[model samples]
Target: MEQQATAPRPRSIAPVDVEQAEAALIEHYPRLVRLGYLVLPPALGRNRRVLTAHALVQRALPRNRVGGAELTVPAPRGTDGVPSEPGYTYVRQRVLRAALDAGRPRGRWQPPRPGQLPPLLPRVWGLRLFPRSGGADELALDQALSSLSGPGRAAYVLRGLELSDDRDVRRVLSAAGVEDPGAALAEADGVRTPAGSRDTPLLESVEFDPCSLQARPTDLMRRRQHTRAALTAAAAAVVCATLLGLPGDGWGRDGAAAPPYAQNAAAEAALDPAKLTQATSSAWKSADRPGFATWPARGDRTGDRELLRRALAAWARPGRAVRVTATPGTPVGPASGPPQLLFAGEVDAAAVVLLHDGVRVVRYAEAKSGEAGAAALDFARTDAADADTSTAIVVGRTDGNVRYLTAPWVTGTAVRDLLAPAAAGQPLHRDAEGVTDATPSPAPSGGCRAWPALRLGSRLVTDLGELVPARLTVGAPGSPRDVAGAQALAGWAHSACHLQSVRSQGVRSVNAWQFATQPLPGGAGSAAWLCTRAETWRGAGSRVQAQFQVPGSRPGAPGAVVARAEDSAACGARDPHVLAGVLWKSKAGAWYALAAGSDDVASITATGGVRGSARGALLAVPARAGAHAELSALTTAGKKLTTLR
Candidate 1:
């Protein structure tokens, strides 16, 4: 009797019909699209990922209807608030399968399936569409996801988006053609969710949502050039066909080419090397403006017509093999007319050319060995660049060293380690072209050991991993002066490491202002609060940080960044005021709410759990550990100011 006993037969999952699948997909369109986006590879870029996500979800409807045969899948368990529905499960599986397929690397012999290729039905032109940027946590999560494999990403998305358990996730991945579902799940475990984010999952952030998107225009001028080129090719083909039909060998003995059609005179002049503008050696002395426009062209190969031609042609239409890059907000369009030639000469193994077109600085470089198709072109926005900001331009960079071309006004060039204030500036020699000797650049990979800054006469400029170095200044926002004095240098030495946050941000200048100093409770010593603001060439995306430097800290130790914000008007020339507060633990092991404000603040106050008001801009109030508080201040001008976020 015991041997005859057996387990009951398992129940079969109901098939999802096309009508039901369509209803479920339309109802949960955004959620499905987001799932697809998270599962897809980040290398496809945001624009393609957005369109592809929508395409995958739209095509998830069942195509087979014979005998009502379609997707047969178990309904969701509804364990994590997701509704349990057979239709939703069917369509979700379809979207997930396509997304995983899209992320796979294409093989040489294997032909791409419909889902593997870029979606053709939802094509976008002239505009790059992507999801809005999220906070630091979301950005970190996205970067972590990018390092995972296709199946691993799928597993993570399934767990986050569907809230499915391991058993359910394995079943789903196996059905989606994943060979090793367990391995994929194990790989996904490597990504650690951000702390204190259980209430708001990073997976649901706007950074991963394709339904809500931001649109930016692509390279409009380049698109127009491509259109013109296509039309020109078509016209040339017609002319050749007509000539071929002509009698008498279809050509004359002169062997002359056909005349050009629909050519732009200004464009032609822009591409002509001879038309490049060259400033006089003494132009800066008498010029109305002291910027790139007044910089003299100084280089040995300035007159090299062949080199100049190659640079100009590459600027106009760079080949596919050429590496072209541009800073944020920098335009890479062809020069409108002869651009100002800043420099053209051999720097190391490559011949380099620098050109300025009023709003942008274009750098073109090519191999000195006359390599036919190898070249590089770079663009950087230099709008509103004045004498202070245009003190130097990076002439050459190789390995970890960088060479700068100083302005004629710069009487002397010196190299100084920004992290070492007491260290004297080392003299940097310049050649006849005003190019300084190669010095160690601030390597991000090297950590905060040392930061090399270029001291051009009385001004200080540091490379922010851009074509143009960002000038360093110190003082009040309304009237900032170049960093020069020992006190200013000492102040900068403590804040130099913070500049890494603003690297490659198209920053024109960074100003550090010592806002307020407060004595710690129980005589733990005084703490200085400084605010550093990075102003960009685009006049947007500016970064502001409020730093707290403890008294008697190590000489080379950087200040602790207490608060930071992006694209904020506070602590800028327009505002010239900032207020921030942080919880501090003194040496006595007592907690205090410390608040500081700029000089303009008439009074400082802390509310909420910790309450205090001080006549001056600095306030310290004893409070329990982990207590929260709100900070506000009244300016001398009778205006209320909140803490800069």
Candidate 2:
């Protein structure tokens, strides 16, 4: 885990300063632009959109009356820095509201007002000496968003771009005159461009100040030529057929070697079976080094790998029509039956098949006729030799990501113990991506999410079975996070990660507990975070009986611990489990703590000390701290689970 630098937290609202206000606005200016772009639904042109977005941010900041007449506005601030009420968050909500006002037909204000600067005829940024690359993705998204109704667009942007929770999302929808937040959420989920695809990331700025941008007339003309040429090339790339055209001799409008306008040999071969066979067996004019499969299979191997490879190779060829041998053998693998061709007969015309023998998996199209083919053949042979007929293959679009093969949850003591609550109707939980593995890959180096860990029920189950919880950290922040909650438990699970705007639902028939984050005192990019832990139990079936208790943790004033040792009357939860630990400052002005879970809730007689039914055990290093740092987690049962440093 990376250490978080402790910065002083504002205990209460302070008078605003001009420098601080400008700095905050400048720092967050890009984010405001992104939010504005999404909120308005981008119907206006780029420059207009940028100008309008800035105007919205101006309206959203904090304002006060000067001399009981003129209004003086300042940067916003709020109490305790809750995601719902933080200063930046407050301004963001107002911007969203302003966007709704500008975008809707019946909105309070009509945007594209005459006061904004007119669109400049040219983009100087596009006039670079080198050809500027473009993604058709942004254009696609703009079109998609424009088609949505104003409210739906607002909901999508808030949930998709702003990363608001269902609660915040619901509020936005309400502001837009929509009553069903859940349905709106589901609809947004359906229409939104997927997260990891070509969708324009909301964090990046694509618009520039057109008024200040400059370019020479010749360069501008050249840029226009390049733009048309690039579009032409891109259009050509998407087409499957190769028509007659002058070969690579001509310079494209952009002054680069035009892609050779030659026919696809694969397409030519597919029109004739004999041609297909000849093409598959022919040696490549320029072959790369040997890899996974470049050779043939042995005598006893039931499957004709050579034939399979050739068939798939032929299948992958453009404009080429191909088919498997009339009948495939009962090759066993994926299931207890014959060899399985996943998505068999349905491979996209542009795609090929992949074969795996439970050990080494290879993309058949990538196989060569020598060492690579031999390696692939050997892989199948070895699996067959062991009588493991679990050979199966997956077919899909050709992006190089390799999805790991997984098996059904095994019936074992470990699986049983962790899911013990399921017998009481407590649904088992996994991440939305399905049962990927026991743990996920790693935290994306760049993104909103941060690292988190937890222990549940008195015993924490592992691959080896339920035992004391492991010392958790960022080591495994990827898939297959331990299943922690169902809908009932999930209600309170919100505290685990208040910072996360997007969320994952149930998988493996269970729900994995996820976390939310808050910005570090410095700014965006996750650094410091505030989260909590709790113990759960089932009374009747899988319902996380109202008895489940959540411990409270308040990280305030930089690295200082402002533990909610005592519950306030406003604490609305049914079971307000209180955890306690010392707040110690370190010599270097950093704050940290080493603590264990003790069920010792302090009693009325004890003088500000540890107390509670801290039956659970814990050990964590909560970031860095100045002076002597202390830590603890307490239970609502009046027991204190504390560790002092």
lDDT of 1 by residue, 1-645 (tens): 466422222233687677888888989899999999898876566677789899999988877762125453444687887757778888888888899988776787888854566789688878777776554356446656866899999989888878567777877887677878888888999887754468888898886889998776765655765666566666656675686688774322111122223468886788677899988999999977799999999898899877787777677766543567788888887888999999999886578999999999988887754555346788999987888899998878753457888898999987777777776676676888898766656754434767878889889999988999999999988899988778798889899988888888899999999988888888888888999999999999999999999888776689989888889988888998999888999877888899999888899888899999998788888888989898889999998998878
Looking at candidate 2, what is the lDDT of residue 430? 26
List where candidate 1 sits over 4 angstroms from the true fold: 1-262
Candidates' RMSD to native: 16.0, 23.1
- Against the reference, the lDDT scores of all candidates come to 0.80, 0.31
Estimated TM-score per prediction?
Answer: 0.60, 0.25
Among all candidates shown, the one with the greatest TM-score: 1
Point out the worst 10-residue segment of candidate 2 by lDDT.
501-510
User: Cα deviation in Å at residue 489, candidate 1?
Assistant: 1.3
